[model samples]
Target chain A: MALTGLFLCTFLLVHLIGNLQLFKADGGMAFNVYAVFMTTNPLIKFTSYGLYAIIIFHAFWGLYLVSENKKARPVAYAMVDGKANSQWTSRWMGVLGTIILAFIVMHMAGFWAKYKFGEVPYVQYERNIVDGSMTYGPSAPIESKKEQFVSAETGMEYTIVKDLYTEVAVAFKEWWIVLLYVLAMAAVSFHLVHGFSSAFQTLGVHHSKYNGLIKFVGIWVFGIIVPILFAAMPVYFFIQ
Target chain B: MKITLKVWRQKNTNTSGQFETYKLDHVSEDMSFLEMFDVLNEQLINEGKEPVVFDHDCREGICGMCSMYINGRPHGPKHGVTTCQLHMRSFKDGDIIVVEPWRAAAFPVLKDLSVDRSSFDRIMSAGGFVSVNAGNAQDANNLPIGKEIADEAFMSAACIGCGACVAACKNASAMLFVSAKVSQLALLPQGQPEAKRRAIAMVNQMDAEGFGACTNTGACSAECPKEISLSNIARLNREYLSASFTAQVD
Candidate 1:
């Protein structure tokens, strides 16, 4: 469970870095090309399968831990000072995890499924060449896709990709979508705050000399920085 | 001084339990909490009624036998002291003190405030010892343990196996107790040979004993009579992780 969880943690950082391309001034071309490259790259494609397996493994393993923990305390204390001992996030990891799970479902349904199998709208780009003009369409087959091509009309090379930036902008334009995204990011932040250092602790990588550093990074980096970057997306799009 | 007591009473492990109140008049400020209880019991005996039962030994506080939750805090409001050491002066006249046993699935009420802590014994037996062949004892000088390390180990060794940590924990986790034993040995050279085995075996026993996982709750240390540090638990995590990964390789 620890290994899978940490693996997913690494995945989150990489995913965030790639997704940040959406903020580029280019009309979704950078984000869309990055998305296409991620989906079509053989290595990334294989990693995606592993990612799916790891998520299921991590979630199920967590359920097992939660159930076992529940059974360990068959009867509840009548007067418990829950805040006296631990952080609220540490105590409510299961609930926060469940929230994140729901968020993942909504995310995949809205974005991933649409890109992979659902009928998403397409964009067209026209380029001039010395001899002839060229027209590009996103609705073309995957095998026929090109990063950049020379136009016959002007003999100038132009790069074209899908308009995922526009797609995200359109989605975030709705108040409800922006609100849900922000709320889900909050859940993700809480989950990561407890889970980040906890993963290392569970895996037995802790030491007196460096344990504090691990916790510090977990709190400031994964807990605060990652979630802020993620949450900024919807807010940025909605306002813009 | 006069004080009101709300104490948990149970006939046996299988029977349901409830709070039974008793008022004590002429309670002396100098009397220990248990002595106050003794006063109440003596009064009950004079009245030809069954007295409230609680576990206690070595009232000076070394023994972990005394277990009680006073007003929602384990071992009463006193810091770094057991229930036996809690002085009645800590309470005011007409104060209501609610006493109860350690409430955990692993710890069932055997009577009015005494709990069956034998599950802790089981976890201890699982891996809380070093395997030394019976023979003449080795020279103490030969071990050559560093003083800093020895001090840390002794601090962990001070754990009385009291379930204050478990009681204080929301999850009823025995991580503090088990970690104390594990870290005590893991820090010493004499405990190296079976360190991995001890880590894995003891943790597995802890799981089987129905103790919950540690969620880094600082309550165990805060409420500890011995003030055992939470660093021991971090060491336990490190030990368990190392042992698990290398178990099959061995």
Candidate 2:
């Protein structure tokens, strides 16, 4: 559970940085190209399979731990003052993890599955490679799709890629979609606040010398920064 | 002062339990919680009724014989004190206090508030001791251990085996207690020879005793009467990992 959880946490950081390309003002050129690279890259594609397996294993393993823990205490306390001794997040990890798993399914179906199989609007950018100027072209189907080509008549470079960036914008435009995305990020934030440092403790990395650093990164970076930034993408799209 | 008590009453392990309420008058604020219980039991005797049963000893706190889930928290709402050390003054004059035994599959209730903690005894016997050939008494200064290491070991040694850790845990995990025992010896020089085997043996026995796996919730430490630090648990994990990696298959 600790190893897989930390792996997923690292994946979240890389994913967050990659998705930051959306905020660029270049008409989704940066984000679109980045998406194509992420999907089509041979190395990343293979690693993603392992990432998927780890996620599934972590989720179900967490549930199994919950059941075993439940059996340890066959009877419940008549009234428990759990808040006095511990953080609410630490105790409810199983519940928060379940929510995060559900969110993963919803999120993947909304964007990842859509980009891979659904009808994605295409954008063709015609650029003067020398002068750094650009233009847009009509959306007629090209029988042979090339990532970049030289237009004979215009004597300029043209690049065509699936416009997944626009698909993200369209999906986030709905209030409910934006709300769900924000809520899921909240769950992620809470889950990670307890999870990140806990992984270290379980893996035997805990000590006074490094505990402060672990806690700072756990709460501020993964728990607050990463989730908030991921959440901002949807809100930015909705408001804009 | 007057107070209402809702205490758990059970005949034995085979029978289910129920909450029974009793109203008492003329309670003094200065009386300890157990003294108040004593008064209630005296009242029950006068009325020819079976008095409520609970576990307690050494009334000071060192014995760790007392186990009570008072007002939903083990050892009551007071921090860093056993049930014996808990004063009645912590509650209001009209408070209704509820008390129950430590509930865990490994620690079965013997009666109303007393449980069989022989499982902990079994775990302790599994690896909680050091074996050496009998010889003449060695000088106390022979060890030459550092002060910091000694203090850390002493802190872990303070664990009174009070099963409050088990009672306080949401999962009823005995990791805090098991880890304390492991740290008490693993930090010292004399304990080095058997550290690997001890870690593996104790944890295996702990699992065999039906204790839940630890999830690193700080509840056990927070509720500990001795305030045993959670750092011991981290050290135990380190020791267990190192042991497992270096352990012999033979």
Candidate 3:
């Protein structure tokens, strides 16, 4: 469970970085281009599919272990007292995971679904096949194609291809939506802060000579990367 | 000086509990916290009120029985000390002290400030014993253990099973208790016979007891009266991993 969880944590950093591209200055085009690349790339497609499997397995197994632990003691203690010794975040991983899961669903629906099947209005531009002269305007209805080249602003109309940076920027610029992304990232960060080192410990990687270094690295990876990647999204969109 | 005591009173395991307040007057700063509790009990007895029930075997701190959460801190704000070892001078004259029992799902409160820590006993029973048969005491020279391993095992064995580690832990994890038992046995040659079973059974029992998982917070060791090391938990993890791997065939 911890191994899978740690893997998920690693995936979060990459996922957050990919999502952060949405907030780039070129509107949503850069993000959409990145997203399109991510979706169409065979390697990313394989890894992401594996990532989905890991998330489901980790979540269900974690819930199973929690329930099994709960069943060990059927009765509640009369005096509910230990608040001094445990970390607040460690104590509430389940709640945090649940919240993050909800946000993940929302995030997928908002962006992943939109990029995949949702119709996005695009501007059309006429281009001379052999020459550089062209007129930019609203293009005809050209259905989304898989791995096919398309102009960022003018969509499929421009034979001269462009990236989807503008679409990504536009998607992330919304204040309320960016706020939710930030929150989800925070949850992911907090979850990773404890989960990363814990996985190593559980996997018996605790050698006295190098355990400290390993834990330190784990802290840096989880404590720093997830939040910064997600936070960069809003900062990039709003500031730019 | 008068101190307000908010004590957790539970009629029984089935019934819910609440904090009941009592006032203690003219408390001596020189008295230990348990001594102060004794004085209050004396007053309660004289006034025909039921005296507060709490667990305490050795007031000298070696027994590990004086487990109490005083003012939100286990063992009452003193580091490396049990509740019995805590001095009244640690508090101001008019301070209100909140006393409660260990609140983990495993350690159910039996009465006012008294919890059933037999979960520790059950966990220990799962694998905490050596398999030595009845016989004459062996000579100290029979088996010579390295001084360092002996010292480490003694430190781990110093844990009194007082449940203070759990009370001090924010997650109510009993890793300190479980690890101490595992370490104590794992350190000696005599413990080798059942080492793997001991680790597996005790950890399984610990999980079965509904205690929260250890997240390596180190709070349990910090608040331990005996100051048991967190490294023991790491050792236990090693033991558990080895045991689980070997047990795959068994």
Candidate 4:
């Protein structure tokens, strides 16, 4: 669970960084192009499969651990105060994990599935070579899903691809969708606050010399920065 | 002080238990928690009733014999003290105190408020000791240890084998206890010869005992009477991992 959890944490950073393209001023061109690259690149495509498996495995293994823990103490304490010693996030990892799992499914259904198999509108971006000015609109009817062309007449480069950016925009247009993503990111924040450092401890990596660094990266980087940045994408689109 | 006590009453390990509440009046605020229990037992005996069963040897904290889940905490609400060391002054008049035995499959209740912590004994036997050559008092002076190392080892050794950590853990994990033993021995040169094997053997026994795995919740340390540090658990993990990966032991 620790190794797999760290793997997922690394993936979160990569995913968050890649998705930061959404914040670019380009009309989703960079994000859509980046999305296409992510799905089509053989190495990343292969890694995505492993990522999916790891996510599922992490969730199930976590639940199994929970069951084993429960079995260890079959009879619950009649009047125990759980809050006395432990942090709430540390104790509710399973519940928070379950929420993140559900959120993953919902998130994939909304964007990933749509980009892969659903009806995503296509767009064409035309950029002038001289001025670096760009124009994008619905692609002229074409059989190819994605194509890049340089115009001979006006020295313009045109790139046409599936408008996953539009798909993102359309999805985030709904207040509920934005709310769900924000809430899921909050769950992600809570999950990592305990999970990041806990993983290191389980991996036998705890030491006083490095404990502070581990905790700082765990809480500030994974728990705060990563989730906030990922969350900002959807909210940015919603409010835009 | 007048206090209501809700004590768990169980006939045996195979039998189920229920909460039996008894009202104790004129309880002295100066009395220890166990002494308060003694008062309740005396009252029960006078009324021609069976006295409550509990585990206690030395009336001091060093015995580690007394085990109770008082008001949801392993050793009552006070920190850094066993139930025997807990005073009734920590509570107020008309307070309801709930007391029960350690709840873990590994530590089954022998009767009301007394659990069989023999599993801990088994774990101790597994790898908690070092095989040292029998020698005279010169043995103590022969091996020298750094003060810092000795202090750390002593901190780990302070674990009294009171099953409070297990009782306090949500997972009933014995990580703190096992790690404390492992950490203490591994810190000393005398224990270095078998440290690898000891780590593996003790961890195997811990797993065999059906204690839950550590989730790093910090409850075990927080509720520990001796305040055993969680760093010992980290060292246990490191030692166990090193053993499993590199140890030559079978």
lDDT of each: 0.84, 0.90, 0.76, 0.93
TM-scores, chain A, per candidate: 0.90, 0.95, 0.77, 0.97
* Deviation in Å, model 2, residue B82 alpha carbon: 0.4
What clash pairs does model 2 have?
none
lDDT of 1 by residue, A1-240 (tens): 667878988999999999999787656666877887998999999999999888877777787878877777776655666665568888888888888888888999899987777765555455555544555556553343335666666666576555566778999999999999999989989988888887776665667788899989888889999999999999999999
> For residues A134-171, what per-residue lDDT tens digits would candidate 3 score against the true structure?
56433445545422344556433342123344454666
DockQ of 1: 0.42
Candidate topping DockQ? 2
lDDT of 2 by residue, B49-91 (tens): 9988888889999999899999889999999999989888898
- lDDT by residue (tens digit), candidate 2, A23-129: 98777878888888888889999999999999999999999999999999997779788999999889999999999999999989988998888877788888887
Ranked by DockQ from best down, the candidates are 2, 4, 1, 3
Once superposed on the true structure, which residue ranges of model 4 sit more than 4 Å away at CA? A140-145, B134-144
Candidate 3, which segments miss by more than 4 Å at Cα? A16-34, A41-43, A60-87, A121-164, B133-148, B215-217, B248-250
TM-score per model over all chains? 0.90, 0.97, 0.83, 0.97
Q: What value does the lDDT take at residue B28 in candidate 1?
A: 97
Question: How many clashes (backbone N, Cα, C below 3 Å) per candidate?
Answer: 10, 0, 26, 0
The CA lDDT at B27 in model 2 is 90
lDDT of 3 by residue, B133-205 (tens): 6377689888899999999999999999998877766557788899899999899988988899999999999
Worst 10 residues of 3 chain B by lDDT: B164-173
Query: Across residues B1-250, which tens digit of lDDT does each residue of candidate 4 receive?
Result: 9999999999999999999999999899899999999999999999999999999999889989999999889999999999999999999999999998999989999999999999999999998997887355555567788888999999999999998999999999999999999998999887888999999999999999999989999999999999999999999999998889999945
C-alpha positional error of residue B181 in candidate 1 after TM-score superposition, expressed in Å: 1.4
Output the number of the lDDT-best candidate: 4
